[model samples]
Target: MKNAPTATNSQSTKNNQLEQSQYNTESLTDLSTAAQRARVLHYLQNHRALTTLEARHLLNVMHPAARVMELRDHGYKIITNWRQDSDSAGRLHRVAEYVLMAGGDA
Candidate 1:
């Protein structure tokens, strides 16, 4: 005999799937604030610019603006450009694109 799936179980499964699809677990598994800031800075150095979506999906930083602000406070020159982008869930949003103008203190 086998037990059938309940509504709660099905809903939980859907939520899990949604969460998995929304975030890159491999990149986000373990990262501290400093690590995320470093990653974002390195990425900006190589890429010259980074969008909010890129920060979230590629760098695994949930709050890119906060990281950017920290970098700015550290004397890094960063500029923000607004643009519309679609998230993992295909929802349109006005996201900030941060462009690195100059490097600051180490």
Candidate 2:
């Protein structure tokens, strides 16, 4: 009987969950968009190029194009190349791959 959760324990659990949710939301929102874009830019500067999937997988960025545009607006010289790739099923598709140019903070 002691192992069972009482009404007070249930209310406390709900309160704890709400607090945790608020904390998580605040922490996530505290990461500014500029910081996210900078992560993408740094990856490009070091790795030379990045694709949309690579950006999502490596940097946890949902929209790489948006980040690229932000970097470009900040005066970063970035270039895009359309790459033709085949998937495991032999389906062909085009992907926009981004590369930092030689000039402008490269």
Candidate 3:
């Protein structure tokens, strides 16, 4: 009976690992806050809009709202709009979609 519990725990641990691996958090942590800000700004400048999911997956930014806040503090004009997006598990989540209205002094 104890062996069955151990097997279940092992499988649970593996599932947790798999979920963490899907996000690639290691690469996100490798980027400095300034670098992450720069990437977010550049992407916004070209694309004009960025979603939280896009920032995480494409720009490797873990906390995009933090980066956007930093940019706003630097005088950048950014606006946040909420939208419903589906996650990998197909659950709907209200995510922030940021739009850059103007550039600030660097």
What is the alpha-carbon lDDT of model 3 when measured against the actual structure? 0.72
Leading candidate by TM-score = 1
Judged by whole-model lDDT over C-alpha atoms, candidate 1 comes out at: 0.73
Model 3: residues with Cα > 4 Å off, grouped in runs: 1-30, 102-106
State the lDDT at 40 in candidate 2.
74
Global Cα RMSD, each model: 15.4, 15.7, 15.7
Residue-level lDDT for 102 in candidate 1: 59
| Tens digits of lDDT, candidate 1, 12-94 | 55334323433443345557665677777778878889999999999889999998886675556889999999998999999
What are the per-residue Cα lDDT tens digits for candidate 3 across 16-67?
Answer: 4333443453344658666677778778878999999889888989899998
Compared with the true structure, the alpha-carbon lDDT of candidate 2 equals: 0.66
TM-score of candidate 1 versus the correct structure, residues matched by position: 0.67
Where does candidate 1 stray beyond 4 Å?
1-28, 102-106
TM-score winner, 2 or 3: 3
Ranking by lDDT: 1, 3, 2
The deviation in Å at residue 64 for candidate 2 is 0.6
Q: Better model by TM-score, 1 or 2? A: 1
